[model samples]
Target: MTAPPATPTVAVRLVPGPGAERVRVLAERAGLRCGGDEIGPAATVTVIVAADADQALRAQRTRGPLLFVCDTVSPEGRRRALRAGAVVVGAAELTEAGLLEAVLRAAHPHPSIPYPELSGVLSTGTRPGGPPAACTPALTARQTQVLRLMAEGHANADIALLLGCSEHTVKNVIYELMTRLQARNRAHAVAHAVRHGLV
Candidate 1:
């Protein structure tokens, strides 16, 4: 007698490029049905396309999450995408796997400690007990090091190289960190760490 869990919704706006079909295919594989073709807003993820810098900027101003799939990765393109409020940007040549990963990440941002949650914890500070059990345990020294680099937006491959570990190890650490923090995803977890002064 429990209600079914809501499926995450993703909106995909086709940017001017040859890869629109490819992007759509990737999204479908991720269990995200097309927006207009399926549902409406009030959905968790909205995928929008910005064909050019101008459109991208406008999309950003609207304060909606965007996916900037461009034909090139020029500095100007990157700047425009970021300015357009894209949390992730990709190129036409980007592999389906890469684009899908970026989209998934954008769709599921990490969970955060809301003011009410923090307030409740702090107000009950130290009580008769030594200290309230840490809601998020301090990351191990190594995990802390990895998280700092992650916060700087380094990819797993780059982080692995920097830490002299395998990319798999970096991924594992990231997974563990997210699990411990109950983060919805990596970006959210990083934001949470930063907000909590954990990293």
Candidate 2:
């Protein structure tokens, strides 16, 4: 007998909020395949999208993976979201593909990134149960812009076009950002940026 196709691992929950329906339509259009609670095994990751951060918080049940889609996230809101262990992105400029990519990362994290997947670098405790090592390297303005775009789920090429620069320049800036953040990869850099509220 042939094996059946596997169900998608993550269960996505789009919270009701301003522009949420639009975002949901994008996810659907992007063909973001996901499993739900009723599937074979319960989904390990839960991606929640909303225009308001509080909508996400109210919708969260446990410390599962949260994908906050909003226009702006306040410092205090960022702090609260970090405490809740969430990942965020700016919704105003989101595209279907951007949303898809972010969801995929939240669902199936890159091995290069630190565990407890979405936890920021400055969690109250360290990895496996503590905080990250002290790391506050200063970043250049270009690097900060790149980091913010990266956090918003923009790829190097996209960043380049959006910033009116060459893709090569974008890559170089990202390299500098990764080094400065002491991040292993792009996703890691974003996590650090989010946790530190640098972006």
Alpha-carbon deviation at 62 in model 1, angstroms: 5.4
Q: How would you encode candidate 2's per-residue C-alpha lDDT over 1-199 as one tens digit per residue?
A: 2222223565466655577677767766666544445433344445566645666777776545667776776545555566456665668878776676666655554312334333343343332311334545667789878876776667889999999999999998988889888888887787666555565
Clashes of 2: 4
Clashing pairs in 2: 125-130, 125-131, 126-130, 126-131
On TM-score, the candidate that comes out on top is 2
Q: Please estimate how well model 1 matches the true structure, expressed as its whole-model Cα lDDT.
A: 0.55
Task: Residues 61-88, candidate 1: write the lDDT tens digits.
Answer: 3334456665444444443343333543
Q: Which stretches of candidate 1 lie over 4 Å from their true place?
A: 1-19, 49-55, 58-63, 109-199
